[model samples]
Target: MDLAERIESLKAGLLGAIAVGITFTFTVFIHQTLTVSNNWVLPAFPSSFEDLSAWVREAVAFGSGFLFGVTYRYIIRQGENPHLKSGAVMAFGLVRGLAQIESISDRFTSQPWLAFVLLGESAIVFAVAAASIDLAIAWRWIKPAS
Candidate 1:
């Protein structure tokens, strides 16, 4: 579908999504800043950007926005109502924050037990993101797309 058509049903609601745009912009900005800073003359990630597990963690954190957006879009499609701009933004923000927590948790390494613990912690974060999106819609803050 054309970009316009693909998002057509939800465009207004997508635009209504308010925080969706800002969240993505900030995510990209942070990713770029981290990438540039990590590769700066000082170079904290001596393992190279490719090998830095931190980058992987960062990637998951950033991807949270996509999952949140999917939920937000679905919310708009199902709720049949629009939401307070700030509420929608904040809702997505929460989802992103949860993702950040999960990403950070997954960054740790050392023991098998620690890995399992971190995995569960990160999964919880992702679950929160998904749940928030579901709740944001269930709460009727975002209307279903027409």
Candidate 2:
């Protein structure tokens, strides 16, 4: 690709990353609120912000968003309009499917309901984040892929 094209790709990727990161973080906050309010089952999250696991989870979440953003950018570059819907379907489908494995595993045998709730929450978060990121790009709030 030419220099301008390369620069445009980089800008698009960065925009996607920022959009996804913010959206995912917001969705996760919503999920946490719901979890606390409903007393839902959750993995043993660190109780303290200073805990290693807490930071690790934060990093993982952001990393996941960044990856998703990059992927979404590529998808949009393929001439997909209604990009938000396409990205949401792809993102949520993959996340929900992967999340189901834990919910169906023998590990959650004693509390299948917990697994169900967790899976539902995951679906909601992924869908919201995906839609938010794509919409931002579509609306030019985020730079489009060249």
Error of 1 at 131 (Å): 2.1
TM-score of each: 0.35, 0.61
**Which stretch of 10 consecutive residues in model 2 shows the poorest summed lDDT?**
40-49
- Give the alpha-carbon lDDT of every model: 0.45, 0.56
The CA lDDT at 135 in model 1 is: 60
Total colliding residue pairs, candidate 1: 10
| lDDT for position 43 in model 2 | 52
lDDT of 1 by residue, 1-146 (tens): 45543554343333323333343334345555766778522121122345556455445554554555554554555444545433544555555454444445544443335344334433443444444455655676533444
Backbone atom clashes (below 3 Å) for every candidate: 10, 0
Best-fitting candidate, scored by lDDT: 2
